[model samples]
Target: MYETIKWPDEMKPSRSPIHFTNELDVAASVETIWSLLTDPKAWPSFYPGVQHVQLLDGHARFGAGTRFETNLAGQDVHASVQEFEPMTRIAWGGYPKAAEHSRAYHAWIITPTANGCHLWTEETMRGPHWIELAKQAPDIYWLTHEKLLKDIAEVAVAREKSGA
Candidate 1:
């Protein structure tokens, strides 16, 4: 019984303050979902909007103190793995800078549920130019977040059907 997730209202309007979440019930188990979520190599394939991803340090396995680099919406983002609770949760946060604006903090969290899993991306943006950038690119961040959730869910379902 999978459910389609929606973007929260707080993330819609340009001036509403930065916050967003998306969740879906993947057909695969928590372990399967966790593998897909933490693997940097699969990110670009699954979430096409992610321009680039590279592990800066640490093993590919999830854990605190790991670091990674990502380019999202033309911004060069750097993040450190802040939390990793095995199959239960993973979170990372850091700053991302672009030519025009920057996000002070960007975070992604994954949580397991009885049926499947939940995923969310939240960013706190701060820059002298953010207000203007937000108005011009309202959907860039939020749309990418939504796409990530959808792609992971679909991949999990496919994996389950194939018995992988």
Candidate 2:
């Protein structure tokens, strides 16, 4: 369990050109939320911007140093897991494979609540590519992340109802 998620020096909001954060309290078990998060295979069904996720390493679940590839932000991104604590926290740093200039770190925290769990997610991005994207839509990442949280919560509730 983590007391707090760690942010890389470069990916800190003060240093990055773009940053996004979203959170929601879900009346579902941490296991339920965590299962959805660690399963990249189920991402396309929920995460709007992600597609064709494939684990680079042989592991079936995300763990420290695990790598994965996905199509995100209109490009192919390769990501590596940096911090992972089961049922409590997970984070990754990624960059578009075709570009050498951009980088991002995404992190999630799960806090147990009286009803269930409180989920918080944040992302920090920097470099030329993100700056240009921000220019086009400064709130793009924020809006997208907001929807992602809603979607995940909805799905989690449904999954619990179905006893899946």
Candidate 3:
């Protein structure tokens, strides 16, 4: 029995002040979408803002408790999996090494649909300098996520067709 996980207070849009959410109706199974979402290394290939991902613990697929680091949107982020639900959701949060105390939480939720599934991704950024950073580059907050979701859908569809 899968249940929707409650959003942590820190990750809540109202609590964070700077938040963004993007959803995509993908023509792929929840498992397929989940696989792509869990693969950190593959992210840079499709997500423009991501430069690299290095796993500090666990394998290429991140599960609960897995720790990793990434260069996202020109920020060095050290993150660990805070929550994971197979084929349903995964969320992570950590501070950007580039910034003194800036922190970010990103989550993905997949819900089964008649044709396929609905993929929703949201992110929240908070800290003393977060607002200034958001003001400096607001596009990274939402636009990149939209592109990432689109890319994931295309990959999932292709993988399904090839029977991979």
Candidate 4:
């Protein structure tokens, strides 16, 4: 079932210091949203503060066990796919290259609905930096993710319009 994101043991609410979930019902097909989400090369085009992206597994699209490296919000992120299901669900675990002690697991789920698909994303953070940030800037991650989902929807709708 592509209903909800699967949280890893370490990222479970009981364990992780920071956890957040965001959802959006986009007016685009599942495939359109999935492609946008899984394409590492296309991230910089739509996602702000994401650049220098590379797929380490020599693949064009993300899949089970795919690895990627990218600079996010000025921090280097190196992550590997931890869970994947085509067109519906995927998740990755990553850590900042400069601060490996700060680790995170991010997951997404796309469930087909009447109009389009319901997009759901959740992220959990562990370690020192995140814990401190949670106390100081509790809504930072949630705000970022909200913007991300809005961008994804806009991109997907534009793609449908341009017939790309």
Candidate 5:
């Protein structure tokens, strides 16, 4: 079971990027998954931890130069579309400015397989304060991310069953 889910290296004291991949056997097609993944408006509905999200003056269609904002973990995170491929991948760098203890870049890639789909979330972090913060909070990031993944997978399955 553990082999199926992998966390990024950044979760460790080394402060590297965290890479996680999970495959789900959704009955939905690639287009269905792509629509849900790219739409910021649908996020809070699927991912409960997301307090709010706003599209910041960009078209919702996938492409370069797209931007959006989200209230994640009580932090107002600003992210821009670094890469956007319809029905395939979307990447963004978060927290544009370098804050004292936090920095992140997150990306999601969606691939259609014979059975269902492959979804992956990659997050990279940089900052000397990460280890200290982790020591104090202990798995805050890990738990939050794990929940997000679970929520996404659950919603996808539901959508598939509903013929969405």
Candidate 6:
């Protein structure tokens, strides 16, 4: 069971920004998905285009108010937890460290289903150069997210087999 997260202004679909949402059903429990989602260290392992992640608070897992810095698509990103509800929803929003003048909010929702869980992630980016960035690589958004869910599902399935 789960509920949609109250998205921040930055993540709102109504806002003016390039927005995308992707989802997949996984044969893993909500707990399993949550474990992988909260662990910043696990992101680079499963998330596509993530080069590195540094948890600002020095915690292995992120909860409400946690901050982190990550390299995405070779660009530095500074972000903080925007919404965190254990086993259900998690989100963060921030800007690029460079002078791209872009900001975005990324959110994930995990809901239990008959087989396992449904994981959905959405992002909205807004800035002066947002259109140009999207134009540069239009396929990145869908392809990246599609890979992200598939990778997470594989990790979750492997974890189940390992009994970890």
**Model 1 stretches astray by more than 4 angstroms:** 1-16, 97-101, 104-114, 129-131
Q: Find the candidate with the highest lDDT and give its number.
A: 2
List residue ranges in candidate 3 displaced over 4 A: 1-5
Which pairs of residues collide in model 2? none
lDDT of each: 0.62, 0.86, 0.81, 0.84, 0.63, 0.83
lDDT of 5 by residue, 1-164 (tens): 22222323443324563333334455556777777777787788766568677777857654566777786655677777776777877767666333535666566667687877776665555564444456677666666666776777777778888777
Q: Candidate 5, which segments miss by more than 4 Å at Cα?
A: 1-27, 96-101, 128-132
The sequence of per-residue lDDT tens digits that candidate 4 reaches over residues 132-154 is 76687778889888988999899
Estimate, for each residue in 68-143, the C-alpha lDDT of model 2 and write its tens digit: 9988777799999999999999999999888757999989999899998999998989888878888998888888
RMSD of each: 6.0, 1.9, 2.6, 1.9, 5.1, 2.2
Q: Tens digits of per-residue lDDT for model 3 on 49-100? A: 7877888975868988899988776678899888898988898988888675
Backbone clashes, candidate 3: 0
lDDT of 1 by residue, 130-149 (tens): 55557898876667767777
The runs of at least 3 residues in candidate 6 whose Cα sits more than 4 Å from the true structure, single-residue gaps closed, are: 1-3
| TM-score for each candidate, following the candidate numbering | 0.73, 0.94, 0.89, 0.92, 0.74, 0.92
Model 6: lDDT equals 0.83
Ranked by lDDT, top first? 2, 4, 6, 3, 5, 1
Q: Kindly report which residue pairs in candidate 4 clash with one another.
A: none
Which candidate's TM-score is highest?
2
